[model samples]
Target: MSPTSASEIISALLDLTAWTVFDVDPEGRILAGNDESGSMQLVEIAPDGTRTQLTALPSRCSGRYVPGTRRVVVQHDNGGDEQMQLSLLDIEPSAPPADLPAGLPADLPTGRAARLPATLVDLTPLVHDPAYKHDLADVSAESVVFLTNRRDGVDFDVVVHDLATGAETPLYDGGGYLVDAVASHDRRSVAITTLSSRPRSTQILVAGGEIATSPTTGTTGGHGTTSETPEPHTGTARPVAVTAADEHAHHIHVAWAAGDHALVMSSDHEREFAAVVRVRSGDGVPASAETDGTVWETLVAADDHDLEVVLSPDGSAMVVGHHQDGVTTLAVHEHDGTHRCDVTLPDDGVPTVIWAPDSSRFAVHLTASGDPGSIHLVDAATGGVSTLVDGRAQIPEGLPISLPTVHRVPTPDGEQIPCFVYRPAGTARTGDENDHAPYSTTGNAAGTTVAGASVVLVHGGPEGEANRLFSPVIQALAGAGFTVLVPNVRGSAGYGKRWVSLDDVDKRLDSVADLAALRAWLPELGLDADRSALWGGSYGGYMVLAGTTMQPDLWAAGVDIVGMSSLVTFLENTSEYRRAAREREYGSLEHDRDFLVTASPITYLDQLRAPLFVIHGANDPRVPLSEAEQIAAALADRGIRHELRVYHDEGHGLAKRANRKDAYPAAVEFLTEILGR
Candidate 1:
């Protein structure tokens, strides 16, 4: 076999499609998001293996089916702006139409169409502004609970919209960044989690006449006041903090349980990891009182790893996702916390589980490094797992796909950075002239050898973890004969709260130092230090620019996608609602302006030596396109080798298949040429 070109390898990997099971209807029909039509679209899969494309909007769309109804509340946004709008789509499977075209207009009429079986009704025109986001929180038979920032464009307010009367009621008008709000089964009470009180820590608030918020208050040695004014609602009752306002920083999430109870996953009680706990409102409390009696019961005790739980709608069972290292192990438990059986996954990958309406079984969406992805149906009682959707089957026969091997790189400070290494298959020349070795042959391409080069791929979020999931970019780089290293440096999540907050505020540059440490240890793994490059997007993109600028002689080339060059300018120009939230992590311009400037990659552009390729979305809301433009201009003015590509129809990242096909291949080609691969 001949050596495959970078473009050919990238294109082939990008052609693979993956779908995730979002919600399952009562009729055993699965609602999913499939990227088969060039972009992720709403899809419905019947129990008999029939798949139907629901929405064909140009932008990616996702939604949940209204409980006990054929109507689905769709959510989408324009280009890559994060202001999502809500709409209602009704599907009539019995009235199937003939030969619908591949790509339909985004603004297709609302009524029944001659070429489709779904009617899309634009709900944004009547309910909320398209300029602001109206994120769906929970949908019930009586009403829809959503959080919208339309009123002030900064604070999200919980609103309950009646499904029958079309009346919208503002349940809680608390001014803060609300994470999630869930209404009880009776819709009389609501539970919400917010980060307004403290940075990086979430406080739970229960609003209703029945349950009283906990009056416990104290400082946590962090920023902001733990005390909050009782927010008055429509009635005489107000929303109050249910969790104790103590010195410990707690990150809690809530969902409605059986009756008047709410399932809570909290990191409090002196525990380093979050644990599942059940809470409910006790009787004999006045509606206007400051303290409504509340009872708490521990369900699953905190262990060494963090836990994520999803309760079945019928309240019979729950799926517990145990987060340890970088992967998840799912287990089913009875309503009373009795362990049923641990779910056996097809591969060691990240899995997202959603319960069926009946609670008899659940759908597990599994994604691994070696395969594209697949969706499996698990029996809640027997723990039997069967494949419902297989994306691995679509891969062309004999195509090489590299699987990651977990490795830890020790830093100078003694902190070991977790990383996944993907080496090219077949024999490759080591650093020494006489040395030769054969890599793994699991996904081997015959006659292909390592290019003696490597690419360091970084994940965004600074809070996000780099797990062993299917990545076209990583696979493409490995297939092109360059080894790939995905590192979860300090400030990345999944390790614990302490690990994630290690690089906060004044310690921001420490994460970039971790990258330097990773680069220094590359030679020990038989990788060439002179041919290594940095590639990342968003915060990861910021890392790429920072690594190249801070350590000028370390990398041969760099690829930045929608990355920020200056933290000060980025925080100032970011979306208004997002500014405060991001400030908590990156530090605020109001007080830490000097530190922000010092941490910015743009501040040290004069030290940059590596050739760079910058890719950005023209309408990006998070980092802004200006971040990319400024870095590219500075590089040009300094006579540095660099290139830039801006896509007008994109936001934070490339969502469209056409743009990815164009941008990624060009980036790979640039890296190959600059590294002399």
Candidate 2:
């Protein structure tokens, strides 16, 4: 039989999906985002790793198990507008599945013994404008707290709902923007954090029923859209300041700690890096509380590296995740930040630590170089690790899996760029498997010695770092005989703030120079530099355009996925909720139009000589479909070879499984045709 081909790898990847855990119940049942039927839905994973489908929502849904009840509160939205609506799912054993929600595919399997039957209850009816974005903040047995932008489309406000009475109460409209909210375990009070005073200060609002307020106008009760002036009610809410007004502190509320008495958060006040701090959760009546100030104690101090904290469910322990040069290091400590111990893992990548209800265990979505990602159970007390779900289980047996080697490629600016190099494995073309001819025939082009066609894969989030993880696309390319290099360039997260901020605003082009340097460095690693291409999504997509345009002679081809073509236009016509945040990374359209145009790839499209392929979602709210359209139009007018794919059902990225399957293989085919590999 022939060896597995790139197409086979892509097909196998289609059947694979990674689960992101949201919450865990006392019974050890976990609520998570999973793709059981090609669409993301809520799934309950038993303590033993047994999987059970919970909801058949048409779109992606994030869920949390309601304490002491058989209920799960889920947040979902229409298409990909990100305006989520809250829904309740009664996941009791005897719950009937009759009268399922409309638009649920008729072909969905009716019975799965492992799955508890569930009934969907639309909670959106409690809010007036379901058109605005709503997010789940916290859930208790009797009530649920959510943040919504229904009142003003710009800032989010806190809203609490009683599960039993269906009574909705507006809590804390202290105005600015609500960053996050966490309900106390006793359900008597809630702590809300506002980031209105960014980069310098923050306010923590603690409120109870005494401080609840609901607007008198715009009560749509899930029906008409008559905008009425909501009679605002001022509750006895007490505001606690975490940082001084003059300090450059950025306070981010993380979670409720030590029952309902305190909260855990990250504050960069008077420090270069953000550190964890535990603040007093004042009594419902703030005037009577005996706390000296808002901040009670510093749980974790800011060290040389930035910190990410994950508190145990019982608030007994905490996990500190920090990164250096793109690899993550996790340390476990007591809830009070004592007794620290580093977690021993087999590989290095960003592992999201989700603590179980008992605080004795944690589930980590672990990933490594050449491995997509998998869910692993970690012992909180002993720092032990074990696999719960193997994300690569979908790969066929006997296929040669590729692994990456870390290469420290030095840049021109005295920086060492960490690059993960994945090479194709060798296989016997005929007869016994022991016959070790290079597994792929595609790489042995003329004048190449033991080297393969190369591709530089850039990751998005100029603020995000690339980690060693299993990516089907990278595997497929390697299987097709290409040497794939993924670099964590400047402006990537996980590498301290200074490194991440290197490409911000006017310094953006320096990262493009690093891309060019990577191409020049490829030959030293025995990879064919002349036969290489550039591919990335989002910011990485933007890198692809930049590399192909500014360093046209360096790349054989380029593929851009939902990348920005014109920074100025993107800022001018992106979703209002995201425009300001994006402007911070890319220059602002209002004040820095000329700077944005200078940084944009569309401005230098005439310099691009290589063939290009672009993919985008028509309804993308961030990058928008116009980014792709404009580039495709420009390339066409210039007579450049290119192909554009616009998926109607997708937004931001190719999130739909069917769309990914169709899009990825087509990408491989395009590279094959253009690079002749």
Candidate 3:
């Protein structure tokens, strides 16, 4: 960032309001940190021209033990901007000298904001594995779940664990593709969907008391089948009532209706809300069909991602959530059309509708008249709203962590593109506190902050939309002190049709520009735009490469995690499902090769001036290891400085503890050395 005057260069540093940023030693001791973000420092110079602070940075003083081989790996982006980082020797712990009076204020994280137990910052660093798995992802009901081997050859039953206790229990032991699973109310039962390679019937498994005990499997993970009936349960199974019938009646609800009937909320997988179905539990035999049991849909144009039907315990009214571009909302329904009024969240956040067991008040997320984000519980009758929990709890202690700033940037077509940017905690625009709404402060923010450099974090799914999920990497980087920006660029979902379709086909390159604009705009907000770096995984991995390659002069370094380095290789190696579906975004390779090739980042590799690091998994079925091999081969052949980190046992993204243990350290060293901190 430049100084007060645009022309002159400033130190590109700021004093933080919360815990300071630190770089520590291998023995869990403070090395160096800025005074603003963390505690005061006690300086001690080491032989290797090193400076160690008595009080460690937030990343260093994590109050956790680190084994000799493992180090708390904190990655700073350096923003990968053009300029070199400031002097690292000057950084040390921010604590006051020991001679100072003990009467001074005591500052530390103690209450609910306390750090996770038994975990250190340097525990697992990011590695540039070229073959890391990105597809084997699971959203667990508990913060921590049991390990489920997600490889192709290894056929193993998946066991979902209890959130409080790590007691593992069987959910499904399928060999075929098991995309997702949700446990029932009693926690004893669960609903899982399995599909064969041929897109056959997506069988839903209800492991009530019946399917939990017996497990004699013969087939491999590439394919498996649910017994026509579930085996009896060994012990008492928790009774969980699932109402969601996945699209196409694949695997909807696993309820205990009519003795052992599972109620599923299903629809056609064509991304439409045509037919919603209810099936018997355990066996997927359809018990009934809604929409008047008619073949044709009343709302053909309705935008339905998945069936949002919440069936009442009495089986009378089912609250169905539907979206029709003009009107996206939830309504109470039965065999007839909607029975009650429709309820919509603010900007339609795909509301998570939780009905009381009695079905009186439908607790959901909603937008208040003048509030940025407010949670409300509505009376099912009058539709009157009452605020239950306001996320705006005054943070009397910590840093000023802001929510995502939603801006509608102007595109070439004069259309407004809604972009979400989350600034680091304790960092914000210089204005009245109340003028700016409390930022959602979602996703992940690293622990510490770099003095000058910031990272432009990218979200995967080129078609994926950003949400308020707990992100470890983002939090780690923020703890290490790097400003992060996650943009919901074109091709991302959740938006209307036009917004999502923006990155389809020839218009794909626009994502790169939208990102570059983010890079340029950061400097205007007191961040070091020129010193920023680029990092992301999956399609985000692709973006990291595109960021450095297309804007070669912009980033000082690039970190690609399970990203598509070469579209051609990715397209050639990916699964048939992905190859067919990805065409909507990149265009069908068989039909429009030229148009798809134009959006491929490999088309402009020669433009990559920044040092690049690419990581991937060997068993990635979606984007094969060949994508990394091609890019690595090209970079090596071109004599361009690069690093390739590969994980043989994983696919898409890293899952194994051993893989992350090695990978995260590599990322820290690379970012630190390149970022010059």
Candidate 4:
């Protein structure tokens, strides 16, 4: 079946769940509405017609209601957090006409309710509920807008949504998935970061007139031109100044937009800086002056950072959030592109930045020194920070600052890998965290100079890599007195595409070797080369299995999280949206069967000698729970010492605070017991 015409298109198009099905009579009144989709989680309407809401809803009595249509059209799928509308259903006249609204347009579709398309509801046994397949790290629906990003290579998009009709259209067309995309003040245009395929190269694309299209779903409205290639309205898409420095400008970020200007910021991946760019119909204009750079170089290389800019709605003020060395920096800059005030931070792992509409305040996902992760709000002028989401102490008790020592370990190759390794300053054998430290019979892991126990961290995405996100999980282990090392390895993103694609098929084992090289480097840093453990979740989890099996004698224990115990199971159950991408990323499940089998960690179950902890989210539609079962059953058959923790309600990554809490301490104990101080 054609990809576009695949019977699943409707649900795929409507996947977000927040959509509307309705008909607008030629008279401009909504004659009827199908049960609101997507918005089910957002609004609760009492049987009596009263409504309670999770997000702001659009006014039903308001503007932009298309004149009339019997033909139902899906208009927006991006408005999950706010009120939205889909399209008009062509309702048949039941009786004599009432006086129509004088402002209603006369060009509405004929008066007839159309039958639902047979292909609308996908009846296939294999179908993804009309929701995003890629993990949406964040979702926003306000002012009829939705923006999202994935751990995958897909570029981020900011969609204009009409929840009333479940229609969403992209605001613009090109660039790598952006970390942030937003609209400008007038709502006449939008300013956003361009996540380009190049990863390092980014551009600012100001949309011309609506292109006669839905900015979210890209469905054409009469305002859009007939051209396939989008062009600026009047050759006005000006290339404004993006950055003053050119040190691998990978994480270009747009904090916010307002007026006709945008507050744009960029970093060297370690320092924060900005520019005030004026937006034209299709391009941007740059304001003069540049702030002295602030600290950047977050967890991994500057290239691994997600974004650095956040601006006020009117693009008047902004902040540049970045990290340098092991510290994160938050810099507040004046909108006219003048001077900036900076604050340096440590323990706040890597941060995700969001801004208040006026740019007077901002927020970040914090990874403070204590180990629990958190989300905090900050005053741009005062530079004061307050926590919104506190760190949790295991799932049972919640606190955000207690998160992990999530960090990026710079490898000898100049590449940075995600690593979580640290022991309390002088905890000796044990502390409040855990006992014996993970993988520390005597000393730290291979990379850091610290004398703590060492834990080698692996990221889940063989296509993904580790970075500086807060992890109470890592902190608990460190508090227990162990060191962790997370390697971006081969398949991680934030880097160029080639770096990510390097691990596919024939080169699968190279990552295993990369870990080995890292292992050999631990001694150089004065960390214990002997005291080390391998652990990870998802692809990272798979790394635990692969790394341990590839070099059984190299470490002490292994921890896997929703990892593929067997590549066979992974290939069979992997979500369809991810199927083609994985095949292209790794190897064909059918054609390259042998290579896949060889790469399967389950295939080498018998060689596994260390105690292992396997964790899985039972509802994980991507890597099904069966993967853990197969590996555990195999381990059981062989009488291996391995424990499995299953979270029934969670999906791919741990969502509930409780799940994260449980998973962390359990992982610590398992690793420490096997590694032995």
Candidate 5:
């Protein structure tokens, strides 16, 4: 048996198509996004497995079908800037010519030809500013609600656009990053979540009644109105406080429940993990319900694991996605907190649940280390699962697909760091089995080999988790005969809230130290200790650079993709709307500039001994391209061994297949040359 070439492995992996179902209508039609056309595009999947491509553009797109209509509200951006904008795409068929001139054949082209070609109607043309971003929140039969910073390019205000009248109304004006908002069943109320300066802490607010009027013209104006007398009222609406200001906790995945109730997955009431809680609509804040006269009911307890919930369209049942260790388990429950049945997925991987309008069955997008990604229809009643879309159909036989083994590395403290280890094909177990006890691997367990080289792949977010999801880069590295270790460091999520905030602000370097810990423990897993490299993107990229500099001797090489070299510069050059939210995690430049400077990877550039490969997106709005340029420049001036590649057509990460095919294989080749296969 011979090892697969890097290009061949990447090409086969990149060719794999993963379908993510966005919206499912009552008629069993699914609106999904798949990269079948080289970039992610919206497609409509009929009940009979018929797929109709609805969008074809240079950039990737995601959208949901407008409820009770043939229209779809598409969210897309220029290049990969992340400043998303909304557009209207009507899928309804155009009427044939009433009287064909001297045409003998009356039957026009049927099927796809009978339908009008999809064309995007730009909804934000009045405020088409790339500096600001507009994110779709919720869509009703007659209106679309979105969060945008077009007003000041800082605070995100929830704006409601009338579908028929085109009149716009500013529904809410909470002074924070309005991350999510969902409309009630009646469309008279909206529940929103706002992030404060604290990490993972979000405040939930409910704005009810017709408090604001619609504007007739300007940025707030609709595309065109049919009403003779349009109502005047287009500004920001004040919201009633649901969560108190001082009671800080992580609240997310807000959904409208039965009646005026709202379901939120929150870590409130002194809980370490988030649980689904039902908040009864009222005038007072629900956080102080025990002391005050409000009602806060815990529908689903966290039970030692963080949970995410998605309510059915009809509000009869909900799916709770439980996160334990690195894998996920989804369970269904009744609206009244009754445990219905646990959804059985194809494999133990991460699943994103999207409910059908009829609530009969829901679609689950499952992805694991071995499985690329596939959409399955799970019977809500029986928990039986069936494949709806096979994402791995294009993967050629004999392709090396690595399934990760879960292991825990002990820190200097009493904490155990979780990591996913992937070894190359045909590797044999060499170490004593009891050396690292209690480690489990998904699918068929493969023997671990004493590899000469390994790659430590870090996940971004610092607040993010490294799960058992399929990663093309990891597979490529493993195919190239390198052991891959993906560690969920101290600051990573999926653990409790305390674990996520361990490296906040001044303590940011503690996460960098975690790399050192992982490297020291690598030999126990039958991996070479001195030949480990670091690779990550965004914050993970930051980790790569930080490990190479702060812990200079720990890594042999480093690959930083859109990572921040200097936290000070990152905070200074980041988008205005992102600064405050990021400040809560990293220190603020206003007060903690010196500390941020000390924690930056660039601050220790003189100590860096590892060769570096830098990749960045020119249009990245989160971590600006300057972050990449500065580090690359510093390395060049010092005559260090390094290379930088900037993609003009991308943002934070590679979205197009062409760029990924070029970049990732090149990265593998670079690492192989440096690490020695």
Candidate 6:
């Protein structure tokens, strides 16, 4: 077969549709959905892998089955504005008049195999505000708990909606923003995680809105500064000091264990990496609270990377997912955090694991370097695994796939950057180690010597991560005979928190330095430095623009997808709900304006030598469309070769399938032309 063209690869990938599993039913079936027409239609997957569409609603909705009931409580919103409403869906099959059961619970678990008429019960009347967004917290037998934020408020207040009467009541207001809330298995208490006390800080609160603290006050620790413990709450709930109240500390709720009497969470309080700790209800304050003592029970210590835990329903065992380097490592552990054994998952890819309702089995969605990916089933008892669904099932036949090879490049600053390298399928790996022969001499499958260009694919989030996953865009570039190097540069998550925060605020230029270091080391890996292009979306896009401007001659071309050109303007224009979080990552607009302007890509545009291509969604809320417009206009006026493509119906990123189908191929063509393909 001939090498796949850029257009061929795009078509093969866009032809497939991907479904993400959200909730699992008691019958061991899966609940998954895909977004269409700006709404997600929930579907039921039988044990035999057959999928049946369950709901047909006009608005976007996601449903969670009511415990022990045939009804699913759905949270939906109009036109994707995210102001969600509660609705009950009864999917029980229609029965004959004589077979009707008497006194059924207000909500019941519905049949999986039978095609039932979905009855929509509007619970939106319970919430008076039409502009407030609602997020499902916990669905209990008696009530449904959720968090709601009005247009006028910054924090989300927890509310409980009773199933029988459809009455809603306010539960708690943390004074700060609510991060997450989980009801105990027993449903007696709810564990709420909040970041209200300080910027990027975390606090855990048990039900009744109580703040648990030590009996004695004035403990010294956290930032090496002595902190006077706040007075313990004598109200319905107590605030437990899982970590010190340092402004830099961030806690993410993992799960509630020991029958809801304890909380399991991950925190980077004083450590470089994040660790998982299980805090009992009355610990008052963690030992880390006492100037010099061990932190909470230390369920799972960080091993140079971030650790995340998912406890089974019974809390007897857990799957400890460790993000080391750039890949996920799954290991089984006792509920108390003792090492049990390892559960092997696909290497060098992101794995999303979901437990069966009974916890006896788990479904892991793994996406590797090529093709879309696959969902695998794992036996909890033996760590055995099997494929449950192939994410690449819809790919056209005879399309080639490329896998990524992981390598670490050491920087002068002593940081080891992990790079995922993808050489086109037939590229020769047998070249001499000492020859220093570049990629131009590599032979393709057709046995012809091809001068392979290289492209640096940066990922977004800066705080987000770029794992080894099935990226159609990356593979398409490689299929067109280009070598792709995706680096999880500093400030990227999955690495230790300290490394992620290294590029924060004024130190951002250090990360751009890492890009120069990456390009300099390319020749050693048999890649061409002169023919390389810089490409990324979001934060990665920011890096592309910055790299070309800061290190003007390093890249042959550049692509930015909804990336910010001016950090100052971005903060002033981005969505209100995201401004605070963005400030925490990029720095404050009011006080750090000078630093932001210095770090902005636009400030250094005069140094750019690479031709550029910019893509954006007209409706982007995170980095507004104006960010792209300003940069494109500036580049045009400067007489630099550039092109800008804006999708009118898109937002923050290219989400719509049709738009991606058109945008990606065009992007490939642009890069290929500039790279001399």
Clashes of each: 2, 14, 95, 116, 2, 16
- lDDT per model vs. reference: 0.75, 0.69, 0.47, 0.48, 0.76, 0.69
Cα lDDT tens digits, model 3, 466-573, are: 654324455444444456666677766555444665775677788777777777666544666677788888989898888887788788887888888767667777
Best by TM-score: 5
lDDT (0-100) at residue 463 of candidate 1?
76
Candidate 2, position 99, lDDT: 88
Cα misplacement distance, residue 379 of candidate 2 (Å): 3.6
Per-residue lDDT of candidate 1, residues 82-118 (tens digit)? 6777777667532433455658764444334322433
lDDT of 4 by residue, 148-252 (tens): 332232444445543345454555444344444444333434555553323233444444333222222111111111123323333224323333323333434
Tens-place lDDT per residue, model 2, 1-677, is 33465666557656667567777666777677767577678787887778877776656677776666767777777666677787766565443388889998765655422244333332324333446877777765556678887767766777877666777777766555566776544444556766533222455666664212221111001101112222343553655444343343456646666545676767665566778877663452322223454445677765676777877755677898775555667889898899567788767776777777667777787776545567777888888888777766645575556777666778987998878777665522333332322234443222123235778999998767687666778877776667788998887755555666678788999998989889888766555678899999999999999999888889999999999988888888887766665775677787888989999898998898989889998878789899999999998998989999998877888767888888888987888777663
lDDT by residue for model 5 over 74-106, one digit each (tens)? 888889988887887767654666665676666
After superposing candidate 2, which stretches have Cα over 4 Å from the reference?
A: 1-3, 93-130, 174-179, 185-239, 244-253, 259-262, 266-274, 279-304, 340-347, 384-386, 427-451
Misplaced by over 4 Å in model 1 are 1-3, 93-114, 117-128, 197-199, 209-237, 244-253, 266-269, 280-297, 427-450
Runs off by more than 4 Å, candidate 5: 1-3, 97-131, 211-237, 266-268, 281-291, 430-450
TM-scores vs. true structure, each candidate: 0.88, 0.83, 0.50, 0.57, 0.91, 0.84
Q: Candidate 3: where is the Cα deviation over 4 Å? A: 1-412, 415-419, 425-429, 432-449
Descending-lDDT candidate ranking: 5, 1, 2, 6, 4, 3
Query: Which residue segments of model 6 deviate by more than 4 Å?
Result: 1-3, 34-41, 55-63, 75-87, 94-130, 195-201, 207-241, 281-295, 346-348, 431-450
Ranking by TM-score: 5, 1, 6, 2, 4, 3
Q: Which candidate number has the best lDDT?
A: 5
